[model samples]
Target: MSASNHKDTYQATGVFLVLMGILYLLDKWIGFSSHGLPWVMQKDTMLLYAAVIFLWFKSDKSVGIILAGIWLIQNIGLVIALLGQMSAYLLPLALLLVGVILYFISSR
Candidate 1:
């Protein structure tokens, strides 16, 4: 690839990795979550970041697939939490949209 293309790709991937790092830190540092919301040590969030790392080292398309899968599952739980009688539905809604947006960008 051209220098510019490589730089652009690196920039994108670097940003993604940084974001994942931030999430991991937040999950570790901030301990505030119930059962439904995506929190630290949770499977969905952990998987998302792990996929990010994997994709960064593996392939972009593969990362996209992993992100999409994680987001899909989170989005479903978010919907259920919001529409159903649940506690603190706001966080899930936010997390759901974030996951969807991230995977959307990754996938396409």
Candidate 2:
């Protein structure tokens, strides 16, 4: 792929990563969840952002592509988990919409 193509994909995935990341942080810090745990700061969840960074650093299609693949997979799982939750319908829908948009943009 051309440099521009890579940049576009990065831009899309980067946006997705940042938005969800902030959402997670806000939910935790603002006491949105009553479970005494921040959803975004979870150990495993942080790996997705780390992978996003790796995707930025990786120039090779193999490594970066693999990271992107994993990122998409993880995002799908996150969307599914969120859908299963008891939160208001709109929030989950918005999250799923973002996830779908991210995956669609990232995969291209």
Candidate 3:
């Protein structure tokens, strides 16, 4: 394949991966009930995923990493809450670690 075609394939794969991740997260958080997609996924979460996918596809690493940190925290908070571990304060600490990692990654 030509160099440009190879790059386009990589970008398309990235977009697909992002979408799949978003769908997985959504399914984990909110199972498909009697209602459909519209009522299943949260608006803010969808928008956040959209931003992540867009930035990633555009090859904007720094902003994508920052947004990914936010997404991780949000999803981890939900999981921790569901497991009744909210009193441990681990969610915030884990988020802090994720933030630090994101900062370091963006700096590079």
Provide TM-scores for the models.
0.37, 0.32, 0.39
Tens digit of per-residue lDDT, candidate 3, span 8-27: 54784577567767777768
Worst 10 residues of 2 by lDDT: 56-65
* lDDT tens digits, residue span 1-108, model 1: 567656655765687678777866776676436444566556666566655555555434555566756766776777566667653675577779978998998998
Off by over 4 Å in 3: 1-41, 69-77, 86-89, 102-108
lDDT of 1: 0.64
lDDT of 2 by residue, 25-78 (tens): 787668645756655565445656556655665454455556656665667766
Ranking by TM-score: 3, 1, 2
Error of 1 at 49 (Å): 8.1
Q: Which residue pairs in model 3 clash with each other?
A: none
Instruction: Count clashes in each candidate, considering only residues at least 3 apart in sequence or on different chains.
Output: 0, 0, 0
